[model samples]
Target: MLSSILTGIGEATQLSALVANLVGVIVGITFGSMPGLTFSTGLILLLPVTFAFDPVTGISLLVGVFIGGMTGGSVSAILLGIPGTPSAAATVIDGYPLKQKGMAGKALGMAVIASIFAGLVSLLLLILVAPLIAKVALQFGSVEIFALVLFGLSTIISVSSGSVIKGLIAGIIGLMAMEIGLDPVMGVHRFTLGYEPLQAGIDLLAAMIGLFAIPQIIKDLPRSQGETGIKIEEKGITNQLPSWQEIKSCFGIMVRGALMGTGIGSIPGTGGPIAAFLSYETNKRMSKHPEKWGTGILEGVAAPEAANNGVTGGALIPMLTLGIPGDPGTAILLGALLIHGLQPGPLLFQNNADVVYGIFAALFIANILTLIVQWFGIRLFVKILQVPKTILLPAIMVLTIVGSFAVRNNLFDVYVMAVFGVIGYFLERYDFPTTPVILAIVLGPTLETEMRRAIIAEGTYTAFFTHPISAVFIFLTLVMLFGPTVKDKIAARRAA
Candidate 1:
């Protein structure tokens, strides 16, 4: 295994693979930073173009785009309160706040550095401990996985950041939303009410688009077209590096975010957004000055950005070692692999070691190009926000249609996008937090699937706590769900 791995590594180190990886990162970043464009759609749009190139070069570049796209989403989320991808939803919380305070440059700097660092850490972990981690991932049975999903669900309280009760209510609403379709296990429809589209339930991506991108558009409108120009300004230079103190202070947060990101990302059906949300909420609550979070602290920028980027590498765990996809983006990645006549599984490392190693190497090299390109490209990116809303909004709506259509080549998704835009507008008007809603969209399926599976196998309730590993996750979920209650009591006692 070692000798073969080395040989594969050697085969993939050529300059062509390196260059393709670098260029792919740049392309991925551009597509991701644009409002309404997503990493998966970006890849889909560009995948056809890759058919003309060498397989290794083409795939390496696509991999580069996927990784870069993850990092790039934070840019718009921080700058224009627009998340370039759904994964950056958590970022928009504090990120948009910083941009509003004219600290956009500082926020962007922190996000970029944290993204690069966490990405490197996840990659290193992948290279050194992937097989070990894969073992741990397998240890997670249905009960354990369900408990983990509950752990994610338990985070809704933290992200509320305003009213815990309201957040819980919102999360419940989201879960209810998730139940709108047929029961996959039972082959029975529950909430569709006989509508053809409703039988499939609400599209998760469309719901996310509603929960995130739509609200921003409604907030920026109602002005005349001639004077509708929103001038985008760079208050400070983009190339500024964050202070050593800032980096040092955020070290623990970054590490924590990265670890958590990797763990969540390894789960099939979850994705970068969940990792980012959990990490951001956890870091914020753990901070000495939790009150300053949405007020635009550097830690706010660093935590979610690093967390999301960490998901980039971790998502590959299941995809490379097992046949399962960690997220929709990886689902698209799986398609790309199939297109190249490669099967992703335990045998992948043995069968096509060069391709796998090439991706690993590409991730490492892409980070360098990503950082350099982003540093120089930040100025131009910031300028994009200056485009007139009349022009940009229409283009965004069009992109929404195009992107949605690109997903499954279905016109229904385009309609789904339009419907969600209205839904998002009203949700924002109510001052409801979308974090929990998006979190539900993310975790709902996993939660239901795991719980049903666990219940069926155990034939008793104790199985969730019977095994040591399952017990640990269950205990953690309990703590996450109820610890805030204990904290509130302690603070009340102290105040009294």
Candidate 2:
């Protein structure tokens, strides 16, 4: 294991690999700091280019992008109250409050500090535990895999705080959308709308962009013509803590958020954004000042920022160990690994130690670099919010079109994206949660593949709950699905 990790590290030090990874990190951070621009989009846009490169360098480049982008999401969320990615949404709920209270600088400071800490903790855990986890994963047959996937789905309960019903509806919609494409296991075509393009099913990227990005942009369109409606109180930047007292009080929040984010991110299908929001709500429920949560508390901003950033490394655990992506960005990383002809499972640690450790080692490097860049770059990123919408909107639109076309060079995807943008806007207005919808799109394919395999093996009605691994997963999934509903019912009954 040690030797293979060393080998992977040595491979990363090659001049070309270093250069490519640096470029990827830069590009990822740029997109991730911009609202409506996502890490998934950045990776998908670059996927076609990897066809011509060494797989090791190519894969490393994308991994750098994923790591950098995950941290970068907090920049906009903290400084401007606009989330650069869905995962950053929880950051916005509290981060913007600090900014409103004339503590934008302080908020960004806490966020940066927490993000770096969380990232390092997650990185350490990944380095120490990945090989062990992969070894355990070897025990997985179809039943275990199905159970793992089911448990991953259960995280939707953690994600949906106020409205579990809405979250379920969103999850079902995502599952239904997944059915639109071909059945991976059976070689059967499912619900294509009888169009040749529809045969490919709804493009996940296009759908995600529509659901998370377009809708938010459209909701803000009314302010597009006005002076960038975001008012910057423009307080001189302060590095002071929100309060020694507040910091001490909120220490547990950040710690809890970071740990929860790390655990959730270790599973495939979930990522930092969901972890952030879950951490935020979880912390709020435990806080003495719950009423002050959305009203601009530093703990609010700090918790999610730290938690979301922490999940970045946690997300990498499964990717590095089992070759399974824990989120969309890592999903792209998986593709990069395959293209390089490197299989990333248990043997990976035994065979590619340098690469494994080099990536792990780079975690420390990237977190340090992220803090350095963000510390000095806050002013520049915040200025983004003040950019006149007339110019910004048109520019964003053009980028949206170009970014979509860059994926497959398909016009069909472009139209799909526009339609989703409209849908996202209306849904946000109605207070429907769009985050789960995107998550569903991301997890849908994995769910389908695993469940079918489990059913095939068991060949019985009880397969879902009979296999020990599957049973554990189903138990968790049932808990996730029913826990909130029961809690809500009990709360209502008491109120009555």
Candidate with best TM-score? 2
Q: Tens-digit lDDT track for model 2 on 297-349? A: 78887788778877888988877776556555665565456545666666576
Clashing pairs in 1: none
TM-scores of all candidate predictions against the true structure: 0.63, 0.73
Residue 71 of model 2 has an lDDT of: 71
